[model samples]
Target: MVFRSQRLSWPLRKGLSSVRVKARAKRRLFGRMLAMKPGMKGSLIVVVEDDDSIRSSIAEILEMEGYCVNAYPNGLAATEALKRTEEPCLILLDWMMPVMGGEAFLKARAELSESNQRVPVVVLSAVSERAQGQPGVKSCLGKPVDLNRLLETVEKLCLSGKCA
Candidate 1:
């Protein structure tokens, strides 16, 4: 299961509690790097959604969690973004949107080279839609995503070189 239970250890929470403010400040700096993860290499997460509020909110959360998030108003925009950029480090796709939905974008992204297509995508869907094992994408995530779970999934995908 890519999305696991979010149960932080007491010790870890205590440590985080001590540096909450520092974490917040460091979050944006790291996010602004256009990647998240240790070393020069970092992970890129694309958040595709039509709703402005949802897209912005998720962007904030992902950034705070130390992720390079690129928010798109729709899948078409995301596709164009992909063309300009290197590849999808990770994709958080909203199911329903105008002008090329998430599934369409997924199909398009799947056709890319394995090296480029290997970017794992976690679909953010409201309905019970799903994307089976594609060249890159990880799995489906029901709407109202648990941020902690999303973070865990991102960490797992970034570190393990495989979607959970």
Candidate 2:
């Protein structure tokens, strides 16, 4: 019995037009409860990225992988959504943005949050400074973010319920 993450199961459906593949993927995702990505039926991912292309691309990739992802133009939007504490099992936040950059947003969130204070955040940015010795961030990806690494972090944090 091979235990795989749900993120792997969803993408298999795209290339595989066969009924067997779809069934197998569904079975794999449901049966392997221990390796499930989120707490509920669908996991939501929040991405605070100013770059439209990068944000869309990343969101599309995660969505294809079966995770429900939301992209924000800046931290404020993502932060507002975070207050609801509904979507996004994890957050992929960019270090730089026009208003309320990642650092400020993070600080504000920490200060204001009564609960959901430990939301996992992965710093996806072109700047290396944010990644180096940055506090309260789970992971960091340099510019031209690596898709594999991003997915890995998402899967790990979403599953474990803690930022690395």
Best by lDDT: 2
lDDT of candidates 1 onward, in order: 0.66, 0.70
> TM-score for all predictions?
0.70, 0.71
How many Å off is the CA of 81 in candidate 2?
A: 1.8
| Candidate 2 lDDT trough over 10 residues, lowest sum | 1-10
TM-score of 2: 0.71
Q: Taking the tens digit of each residue's C-alpha lDDT, what string does model 2 give over 38-138?
A: 46325778888888877887876676566778789998887887777674568788898998898888887776565555677789877946655555577
**78: Cα error in model 1, Å:** 1.1
Model 1 error, position 81 (Å)? 1.5
Candidate 1 segments whose C-alpha is farther than 4 A from its true place: 1-42, 132-135, 162-164
RMSD of each: 6.7, 6.7
Candidate no. 1 TM-score? 0.70
